[model samples]
Target chain A: MNQKTALHAFDQAVALESVGTDTFCGRSPEAYANMVGPYGGIIAATLLNAALQHDERQGDPISMTVNFAGPVTDGGYQVVASARRTNRSTQHWFIELSQQGVVAATATVLLAVRRDTWGDTEVSMPHVPPFESIDRLDIGRYLTWVKNYDFRVVQGHFDPGGAIEDTGDSLTRLWVKDLPRRPLDYLSLMAISDCFFPRIFVRKQQRMPVGTVSLTTYFHADRDSLARQGDRPLLAEAHAQRYSQGYFDHTGKLWGEDGELLATTHQMVYFKD
Target chain B: MNQKTALHAFDQAVALESVGTDTFCGRSPEAYANMVGPYGGIIAATLLNAALQHDERQGDPISMTVNFAGPVTDGGYQVVASARRTNRSTQHWFIELSQQGVVAATATVLLAVRRDTWGDTEVSMPHVPPFESIDRLDIGRYLTWVKNYDFRVVQGHFDPGGAIEDTGDSLTRLWVKDLPRRPLDYLSLMAISDCFFPRIFVRKQQRMPVGTVSLTTYFHADRDSLARQGDRPLLAEAHAQRYSQGYFDHTGKLWGEDGELLATTHQMVYFKD
Candidate 1:
């Protein structure tokens, strides 16, 4: 297929076919495959998409929490999204993603109709050079999903050798966008929230087995604001708080090119030392 | 009832009676009442207690996310806790709370058997005066639930008149413990994770109609460590990130008296101007 006619890899990966009422079928594409299964970001986005495409969906997503119950195998999977409760301005959803009749992931999404209100951003965006000023770090050698995004690291680049000897913090600030530059939307924004390398790898200075147990993202920007962002690279930063008892959690923030806070995300991850 | 014979208010509030396999009956106690409903913290703890009391519970709680679907009335309720998936060392649960046949809240909890590992706390505990040195703040006149916890504010005390005109940040640092000094456990820890007053009250300096849409807490301390804390006050701190589009989010941390990081929580709330 010609470049213009070809579908974006992300769209293909998260695409779902409606099979029944409030139910959809999806598949894990090879393009976004990780070492074991698929990239978690794609799985999270796919789950959110199930609710976003629901016939009874009321408003834009405000908050979503996706729990990785188990490893999703490479094959066909089914998503069941149900609106457990609906109010005048808000709706609550319970979504489940299963493969071969076994539950793999579950998510709870909160959608609401937001209005203009007295607004403020307490946290300021980090100071970083323009996206064009930094060189793109090629990480496609390690993970196939990394090839789908263009990453310009401003700090906390994953260095195996230097990380062990140097006592540096686990803070990664980067400029990233889709490989072919897709427009900024809730789906893409959801995927970008998990695009950061596991903070343990950067903190311990060594590659270890890590999996996100649960992830929560809150959208601050509305539909119109996100659409105005276009395909610009968002300024993203993440940092870890505590690593104990074989678990750690990190909080992240994403900003538009004009420094508008788009979304904030948090996740608890399990790691093997 | 005598003091020794009487059950603690918190214990009575979160008490549940098993009805069937994985189903339990609970109630909204008048002691823990909020302005509109029971405190969100008590509801979250009650849900966690269901899983903890389940027969199939595998390990301690690592993380939990509770979404408030609707206003729970002041009366009896039912909770259904299901182990959606169980792995060797990890288990996932989906819990639902209903009142009069309508779902009022839902939660997803992750439990795992954690082993000793290399540990570190990236974020340092904020320096504050000892709990004994700070003066106690009595706020029971505004909300009934405030009577359950003894609070000592070190900074960011809620002031209506001063907050309206003074331009300051929304950061609350306090030392708090159960009013009757109960032992610290997973259930009480979960409840304490959400005891902070709404960050907006501190930010906007005015009490508006605000509700928590979703709450997530990650526990870093193990059962032994929490048991060691026994009836001691925890140094808690909370701060907001962004407030826009009729929504806001806050990140909080709770540390033990010995500076051991215990839990980290994040919540997204809905607010009216």
Candidate 2:
């Protein structure tokens, strides 16, 4: 197919085929592969896509929590999106992704029909240089998934040769957008929420075994706002609060070019020393 | 029952009786009633309690996301806790609370066996006066659930007669603990995570229709550390990031008396003007 008629890598990676009932069939595309398995962000987007494509879906997703239970092999899997309860204005969903009859990941999604109301933003976006003013750090050679996004770091970039004593704070601020230029949407926004590298690598200047245990994202922007965002880069900022008992948790915020807060995400990560 | 023999109000509220293989029965006690229904915190704690009390449970909860699907009536409900996947070090749970076969709330819990590792707390506890120095704000007459906790507000107290022009920022820092002095535990900590009043009320300083759509909590402390806390008050701080489309999301941090970060919580709230 011609480049103009071809599907974007992200679209292919998250593409799902309806099978039977509320189940769908999906595959982990090679374009978004990570060091161990598929990039987690793509997996998250795929699980959310299941609900978004379900026939019984009620409204837009306001909250989603995904638990990475086991490693997802690079192959096909089945996703079951079950709408457990549907209220007048809200709906609750229980979703599971299974491979060979064994569950690999699960998610809980909250969908609601939102209306315009009194609105305010208490947290302001961080001031940073334009995306063009920053330099993109190319680490795609190490992790294939890094090639999917163009990252312009303002702070907290990893120093491969630096020692522990030279490490800095866990704060990471950057401007990021899809490499092939995909417009912003709930699915893409969900994927971008997990795009931040594990905070431990930036804080200690050392890479250890770490994976996200549970991730929760709250969507602040609706469809119109997200569509207006277009393919422009988003200002993303994240930081860790506490690292204890072999675990660490970080919170992040994503903002539109016009300073609109798009989403706020939180994750609990498991780390091995 | 005598005072010494009776269960604490919190314990009684969270008490569960096994019904079936993976199901249990619970209640929404009057002690934790809110303006419209039961307190969201107790509902969350009770849901987590179902998993904690399960026979196949492993480790402690590292993350939990509770979706308040429908109004939970002030009566008995059945909770079904299903362990979807149990890996060597981590376990994933899907829990649901239903009354008369109708689902009311659902939760996804991540439990893991945590070990000691190199740790640090990037976010420090805010410097505030001791709990004894701040006068407690009593609003138990309006919301019965408020009486279940001792709230010593450091700032952002509601002014029942104040105008919107005199409203302050959407930040609330207070020291809170269960009433009647109950020791701290995972169950109690889960409930306290949602103890803060809605941020919209603090920002607008007006009483409006509002309810939490989803709540998530990340536990940073273990059983031992929680035991050491022993009924001491915890410094709780929460603030909103954005309020739009009839929904607002907030993040909170809970610190022990010694300034150790205990838990971090987030919630998405729905409001009607």
Candidate 3:
């Protein structure tokens, strides 16, 4: 779909009667490219949108788990969501995504309320270069689209490397924000989130895209902090659970404009080495 | 390890830990397994454990996302979990897994409180066979050695297929219980939560193993719900998300006696058809 079309569709999807988390499961057309090939992140995030709408126990709707069911064939599909329990301490929902009349993906979502206390702030955040110290690497694809973001190296090259604790001390710290001309939004949150791949591969010179196996994300904080980035980007860090059998799971922490963290996620992905 | 020794260690681990969401960053021998061949359900439960310990806002924790990280290997590892925002309308956390001093896996978790109202309930739980009607299908390599317990699928068949969801139905309600029978604990919850693959192929005569790529789980209630009767089992209904590119994500929901919704999970898995 074209930009305007995609945007219109996104808006429609967001407003659809069946789109919200509290509603029954319904698949968005944006979940697919053609039909069979699923847009991994989009499908997963859309599911998140479906569950958070009803999560009552969670102080915030911040985390989700999804399973990729089929080839994401270019066929239209529907999403259905239900809950097993709505306990006051926790609310859990079960969702099934069907494509071509078959279950394509299923997920369970957990959300919790926030308890803010100036707890023991003993564990210090990782140290990395300042956002302004480095020149942003452009590896084609989405370079112009990324001018609004910023990052610092904490580990690997800023490319998608799904390797867990490699032998090297490769790490990255990114500060992401939109250009003054364009502000940020939920889609922007996902857009910057989509950029974590390169930031994860900081030690490398080339960019590698991995077909993620699964993704778990938490959006616990507000985006206001990101709005204050000025010329800087958000600070983000990612780590691989491990790399074995051609698949890997990685988790990341996305810090808001302040030193406080905004969101976090763990992703299982497959990469072509 | 001897049962006494293992039990002692487990108790110590549970004790050394105060229930802080940050402390939920689970680092343990089990954490190592996620790095190298850890079963998907186990990984999901571990991630949930941490999210529960940390969440401050969203009432309780709801929702989870598990994407494939690496091939399951054999090794012991540790996990460190911390909340991105512990006091939000909902809560989120960042967890990192390390094996042999290397980061092995990472997870993002969301927590929400529970609410039961017409505006909140959108979907109904799927149907599975009665826990008493089905038999246990021994699938796991370690299942033979009852890790202080034994669980039987009273709803679905122990065989691979015959009335299974695709062939059976959308549910599998099984009766699971600890062998020696102790108070409900996290280990028992972890051990029993794994039911998707074997249950799927159970209706058939053939035995097929679904090697999981990744797993994410959400706990709606508390650990007490897992205390199933030794005579009856939990009924679980599971279905494949889809299977192609030689990979797919599958999911299952477990219900206890009196049809109480216990827990749910999504497994990113690969099954050799």
lDDT of 3: 0.47
Q: Which ten residues in a row have the lowest lDDT in candidate 3 chain A?
A: A114-123
Off by over 4 Å in 3: A1-39, A53-59, A73-76, A115-122, A127-139, A142-155, A158-170, A178-194, A198-209, A219-232, B1-273
lDDT, candidate 2, A150-215, per-residue tens:
999898877666644435479999999999898998999999999888999889887789898899
In the range B1-273, model 1's lDDT, one tens digit per residue, is 676349889999999999999899999978888868999999999999999999999999999999999998988999999999999999999999999889999999999999988888889988889999988885744588889999998987786545354356899999999989899999999999999888989876778899998999999989888988989999999999999888999999999988998999999999987
Give per-residue CA lDDT, model 3, range B103-218, as digits (tens).
44455555533333111111234564554455444535434223433456544444433433434332344556544545544443544566444433543335554455345654
For every candidate, how close is chain A to the native chain A in TM-score? 0.96, 0.96, 0.66
Answer with 1 or 3, whichever has the higher DockQ: 1
Tens digits of per-residue lDDT for model 2, B1-273: 676348888988888999899999988878889867799999999999999999999999899999998889978999999999999989999999999999999999999998889999999899999999988776643588888899998977665566345354789899999888999999999999999888988888777888998999999999888987889999999999899988999999999999989999999999998
- In DockQ, how does model 3 score against the reference complex? 0.03
The model with the greater lDDT, 2 or 3, is 2
iRMSD in angstroms, per model:
0.8, 0.9, 23.9
Chain B TM-score, candidates in order: 0.96, 0.96, 0.65
lDDT of 2 at B81: 96
RMSD, each candidate, Å? 1.7, 1.8, 22.0
lDDT tens readout by residue for model 3, A70-137: 44555355666665444443345556566656555556565443333211111135666666776665
> What's the CA error at residue A33 for candidate 2, in Å?
1.0
